[model samples]
Target: MAAENARQVEARVPPQDTEAEEAVLGAMLINPNAIPVVTDVLSRDDFWRESHAIVFDAVRGLYADNNEVDVVTVSAELERQGKLERVGGRDFVHALAEAVPAATAAGHYAEIVREHSALRALIQVGNEIAEMGYKRPDDVAQLLDRAEQRLFAVAQQRRVSDFLPIRQIVHESFDRIQSSQEGKAHEGVQTGFKDIDDLILGLFPSNLIVLAARPSMGKTSLALNIAHNVGVDQKVPTAIFSLEMSGLELGDRFLSGAARVSTHKFRNPRLLRQDEMDKLVRASAQLTEAPIFVDDSAGLTMFELRSKARRLHDKHGLGLLIIDYLQLMVGDTRAENRQQEVAGISRSLKQLARELKVPVLAVSQLNRGPEKQTGGGPRKPQLSDLRECLAGDTLVTVSSTGERVPIRDLAGETDIPVWTLHPDLRIGSRLMTNVWRTGTRPVMRLRLASGRTITATANHPFLTVAGWARVEALRERDHIAVARRTPSPAEPLDFADDEVVLPARVAEKVPDERFRHLAESDVLWDRIVAIEHAGETDVYDARVPGTHSFLADDVVSHNSGAIEQDADLVLFIHRDPTDETKKGVVDIVVAKHRNGPVGTRPLAFVEEYTQFRTMARSDDREPF
Candidate 1:
């Protein structure tokens, strides 16, 4: 009876399987092949006993170092780590090896150990949750969020996604293709924009779509429009978690979009006329009947958002989830820095999308680096500009010339202006070409055959009288000379005949007029020449007077004003250089669409309202 009572007491303890842990360790020590099998399922923390955890860690160290694993090796490693005595010496290690019958069942033994570890984790999580509930936090929502997150962590610990056979994958792919062919291809929710839909083929389930832009670039408006289209127009359930904006503000924007009433009118209803008031009322009525839900919770954590999203999805069958800007969402509390926090948040959002089998549209902020542009029209956002986000190989467009190029080629070349293209276009058209000089300075001093040195600039000459004289000398190619600028204005610049000028006979051999003129004039020209000599040609070659002569075509063009030959997207925004008007007008550019042809679809943006719409033909007259 006493022994039976003792058994009941022992059963009340937390879940653990010491024998299974020992068996796994024993298999790993005996058979080298068994290490991988057990490692796949178990981590060091999976061992119930502290000594076993230490021994397993030692074994792992040996395996990682590509060393043999045996009783002697594990003991030596533990000793190196100063943990041999802490793990009950070499006798305990030998005992563990004796516990396993063979290494072939290591996988089975690992499974048992993992099962017990998961159960213990679940019990710990349950206790913590219960304690939190009893404590009664001020924000009941936050409490629930923490509890659900802890439970999810427990679930994830036991979840193992193993490799599947190609046959199974092939069958699934065939079914998907068959469905697409049968006109059931719209498996993902549409964003209601025809051009965007054609490019992305709609937002697929378990996908995380990040829409990033600079401040006042209309990313929030675009996100709202998509959510409205899916929830109100298509009647699909949608949820928007706005950390930056309030529910009332979001509702006001929605009413303006649906009713075609200006946001100013919605915000200041007292200023609205009778006709506008009627439109507002009707729009509000329609919106009230829609299945779209909004949560304007401030400083919301990822855990809280995920819990709320799951609840909404389970209860009302959510079709789309939108987060109003990713940066504002609170990250892991234990994260060491902002970057780490952001990475954790991003991974969590992706996992949530997969878990719920729904598309997550996350709004993100672009870095200020793109916004600091002084020359280009209005700076366009790129995938690289995403705050703390890493995007693999992206297709970018040159904003100046609307040329498409890959992002990989642009690395370490940030000062070179580039924009991201919409992923819907295949071919791009050539626009107006602009000449860009690629040297230390725009203007260079040169000496003419008359022994007269003057400063000359590329393209249009400098307006200074002396500069014009040099320009004339360059055009006339008379008494050509080249010189380096002097540090002191009072000192005369030194001219080097051989260093700067080529022989007239050699210069005359070139077909390019600009090159011929430059060479004849003895101007050290080592930059791309874009001019109309016989016809327009992008001259990438330049002759180095002192160096061995080769075909000029060998030199690549690095012109800032001209577009890259391999540009993928053209990101354009309308902002007057004078800054007279508000800046927000943007076009979604798809220079190399993965699914369709390259095209630019204009969207009307009102800076005051922070709203975007399909640009009307009448509005096309406005500068962009």
Candidate 2:
């Protein structure tokens, strides 16, 4: 009974087989041929005992150096490294060779050692995970990701896929082709555009497709149209990670496209006609049954995206995954530079597509290179432009529940409560998901009808009468929304007196009571009096995901790229500069197609519906 109990106790220890470790080392010592076979599968760390590990390391070192690896050579190597006595000397080394029955079982013994090593690694990871639980890490998603990575590392140690025979791979390929011919296997999910579908075949599984364009080029609109086709039309479960736009805004776009109504009507319901309203109701009812899932969570990290996607896939089965612009998603924070971080993100996205066995459509933004091109009717975007793709120095101020706070100090802060506008132009409180400085840029100052002037980047979008429009798009008479009442924070204004001509600087010139009077209030429309250049200054933007817009200097502002190498298909959207209304022909340039032809396909942008439709001809005419 005591012997049986002792055996059980031994079994309970971290999974390790001392006898297998000895056999592997012994087989290597006996047969010179076994050295190559053993070394391929087993590392020094595979041995459970310290002495056995030391001996194995010595043998491996000798073999690596192209020196003879036998009992004598291994023992001499260990001794040279001052580890002979520590690993039980020559006597133990000789015993290892004598104990093995035959060298033929070296591969089997090595496999046993590898299995135990993996188990031991698993135990170590379990312990680390338990400690992590006790510590109660702040970011639970990151902690879970770390735990999953640790377990996968152990599994990967034992997993190896040798090269398959060409004959077998050819048979598999033929089978797939036959199944596709018989309509039993699909080439890929249809992208809803006949020209796009024909050019690249379809959005194939395990492929990363990048859709890139400059700002206001309708990148989001085109992506949404394709997503709608796949999800609502075809009944394929689609996951859209809208890091920039909110879920409600996406819904509005979807409704507008489906009903063939103008998106402007959705934002300003007063403009909605009875016929359009009927179309929207019917469209909403039809789309209510669609298998589309949207996660409008702002500033999502790569790990969080993977975890959520895996869970979503496991539960409802995902056929397609779309990320609205890849550059917005972050990778490992420890990356040395922005370039490394983006490259890591790109690689991770490709891996994600392969792992999930689904098509990943990632929207990308082009750098300012296209805009700076001279002598151009319309500068066509290139795949290389994806490597590039910020807002102004205004002291940002946000108010919540009648309390005023400086937006500058809130950078990097999360879950801060603030009021934001919804798609229907209604003001509601939502947590500011993320806040960060875009960059220092030449700002444009807009003087409001109330004599309140605010400065921001030319590309920064504000809540205008005709929905969100950038500073460059805003005209002198265009009415922008602002808070109707000043925030009644208990603290008085403390801005230092300066000649910087900033909004903050203007605040210092007024009395404490007057500053409070000019503080951010309820939502009201304010007309633009004058718009002019305000030199250059540091500008900040906040991400309020569900609303996509945030209060900046008492006016709503829209919160504002990457590796193309891993992409199997690279597409660029080219809208003519002269088509300022964007209600015209846009070219979908297939810049890089790994398995097919590359050319431009013209698509018409239905401005009212915010949808992309196939062109009638190459002359840039709409089919409709």
Best candidate according to TM-score: 2
Q: Each prediction's Cα lDDT score? A: 0.59, 0.74
**Over 4 Å off in model 1, which ranges?**
1-162, 372-376, 387-585, 590-600, 606-610, 615-624
Write one digit per residue (lDDT tens) for candidate 2, span 1-624: 999985885578787888888888899887878888988897777788999988887776677567898888898888899999998889999999988877799999899989988888888788799899999988776788878766655755733245655655887789888987887635889887878777888898889999988889899999999888898878999999999999999988898888888787666899988988888888888789999999998998899898788778877889999999788988854543344466678888998898778989999877654574435555676654543102333434444554546666777899887766655444566788766654445567888766778877665567654456667778987878765533344122232223112223334676565433333324566778899977656656565544555566666666542256679999999878665665488889998898789999988787777888876535432211
| Candidate 2 TM-score to native | 0.51
Worst 10 residues of 2 by lDDT: 492-501
- Pairs of residues at least 3 apart in sequence or in different chains that clash in candidate 2: 392-538, 392-539, 393-538, 483-521, 483-522, 484-521, 484-522, 485-521, 485-522
Q: Model 2 off-target regions past 4 Å?
A: 1-143, 149-165, 180-186, 388-562, 579-583, 616-624
Error of 2 at 596 (Å): 2.0
- lDDT tens string, model 1, 1-624? 999985885578788988888889999989989997888788877888999888987887678667999999999889898999998888988998889977899999999998899998887777788778888777776677667766765665734345655655887789888998998847679877665666666777887776656676677788898888788878899999998999998988887777667787655668888887787788788789889999999999987788888778767988999988777988744443343355567777877887777888777665453544546554544332331110112233444544444433444343333321111111111221322222221233333332433222232121111121112223443332222221222122353544324434455686776455444331232211221122111112111111111110111111121111112222322233345453444567543332335555666566554556555535431111
Report, for all candidates in order, the number of backbone clashes: 21, 9
